[model samples]
Target: MDDVARLLKESWTLVEEHRDRLSGHFYARLFLLDPALRQLFPAEMTGQGDRILDAIVTAIQVVDDPESFEEYLRALGRDHRKYHVDAEHYATMGVALLDALRCTAGDGWNLTYDQAWRDAYGAISEKMLAGAAADGNPPFWHAEVLTHERYGQDTAVLTVRALQHPLPWRAGQYVSVEVPRHLPRVWRTYSVANAPNDDNVLEFHVRTPPGAGWVSGALVRRTKAGDLLRVAAPMGSMTVDRASERDILCVAGGVGLAPVKAMVEELTTWNRSRWVHVFYGARRAGDLYGLAGLRELMETHPWLSVTPACSEEPDFDGEHGDVSEVVARYGPWTNHDCYVSGSARMVRSTLRALAEDGVPPPHTRYDTFGDL
Candidate 1:
């Protein structure tokens, strides 16, 4: 392990138990340092507090291997553009973060820990700035909600158009969305559900979890036509492997099918021999709200096949039980390129199932909520 990694890991052990206090201290100290910075964050810090702690832990883990985390940091820096994050903000944040660590780590903190953290944060900030500077893309695009179609109990499909700007993105990539109504300046990740069109329009599939956050609830139950939103550049690596001639297998759970759907559409444009199969699952028949769209795609593209399954809905007409089981029945997919998406837990379980079904680890790709 690198010296910085060892120092970060050691300091993390000392402060991990105090994460709650650490996050609290961070915002308190941040605002104290620069009161004007408060406008960049959400009005309510309830859910945002947990996000801070999660971001720190994730950063530390990623920094454990500096070379491997370069792309992630770049993507993160680019995404922070939507939040109006500048180079100076990175320096201010580094100071507040180190102060929080010093307070939380108590007597275990020393000059060595301080120096190591400074070096690590410096490295991170430099890369993030480079990422933001590489693309001449604007910080955020102004978009108007063209349509919001609420379907089923808690699901909605949204289509929005960027105002006078081009938002270029690849299939299977997700973008962070910020709704001014719910929590101003706060953003949530949502997969773009369609291939880019000439009209500069983007589509999204939003599912409201049972006690969803403010942003999600507003999107599903409140956001309507004409509501304006800010969209960040698309980020996520769950894209189609266009160079490979191997067969493709995409597994998705619930709303996770958004990116998978995008990938399928991209495949249709290529007149190639590679076959693609999609296995999508939800809890009940009502939960399979997007089945019709998938069916429509399959009809248009003979090379693409879709299997919609419901685990708890006994009355459903389609395949019954876990979608993983349905996928396993068709396997040992050793040569297939597999892409999985969903919550952390769902992705974790599906990856294991694919592994057991003879899929090589390198052949499988999935995306996490890595919003930098």
Candidate 2:
């Protein structure tokens, strides 16, 4: 095997040998070394430590494949951005990671092994920093709840007044919300429903996922006006590429409309004269939100078309079927850049159907809610 391959194999083996200790020590070292990061993490560091170790080990195992490694790392970097992790914090993480490796390797961890791992991590870090820079290192938003409107029985739409100058984010970018819950503060990511230029006020459409943890449940039950929620700078890659100049197809399922709503708003604002079609899916008519606003936009902007699809609400006006089916009927998708947002299952199935219907993968973008 090549030198790089051999080094990767050895690193993998070493990681496996000291998995438990490495996981434990890595976070311990991090927290002890950087009290700032410790503050950001959960008070129950044990569980968070395991998560960090699992993420790192998964990343390291994929390093031999550059393309996949880079993709994985980019996703990690994007996710971390929501946590407001800066380059300095990443440096601290790297140090902790290396120290854990050293402890795990014992006497066998010499200069050569250390150097190889260092080089690998340095490269990854550099790429991560570069990606963040390219994404326009957006500043964190300090927001106060302007109004919290209960939409349906279980959903709330929060209008926040941002304290900082807003960044130009595409639709589908999510903002991390830090709420003072039980303790240590808890963070959750919510998609922005309002368009980008709606600067002073940002809107979030949130639903109470059944059996969710204290953070989400509390937010649903207790969040009220005048409350402050720490928000991260907008971060996401699932954006409409306006440079394409191609027609656009937007698909949204349930609350998935949040991100797509942002995109559609942007499109309507930028090209009030351009034609775009939107397909929204929900189980029932009551489950659908923002249709009236979308219809208003369509009416005001002559170039826009809105199609609502209800799977269970058969009596609903407009389309009646799965979103993918509605999208197929509206083809040919090859002429448009298709944007999808919803649960992973819905996004995957919709994308697959779109591809099968001749929509190229490059022309399709998606944002899946919940855990990665």
Q: Please provide, for model 2 over 1-372, each residue's C-alpha lDDT reduced to its tens digit, 9 standing for 90 to 100.
A: 135545856766866866778888888798889977876777755445555666667666768777767876775665566566788988999999899888877877778778777888887787777666666544355678888878767677888887765645556788777675343445666788877665567888877767544455556668899887777656666887767878888898877889888887777667844468889888888878778988988888888888999988868987988888888887888878888988777788789889888888878888876531
Candidate 2: regions farther than 4 A off: 1-37, 44-92, 95-119, 129-139, 164-168, 181-184
Q: List the residue pairs that clash in candidate 1.
A: none
For candidate 1, what's the RMSD? 2.6
Worst 10 residues of 2 by lDDT: 180-189
Against the reference, the lDDT scores of all candidates come to 0.84, 0.75
Model 2 residue 198 distance off true place after TM-score fit, in angstroms? 6.5
Global Cα lDDT for candidate 1: 0.84
**59-122 per-residue lDDT for model 1 (tens digits):** 7787866665787778888988887889889999999999999998999899999999899889
Number of backbone collisions per candidate:
0, 0
**Scored by Cα lDDT, where does model 2 land?**
0.75
lDDT for 356 (candidate 1):
91
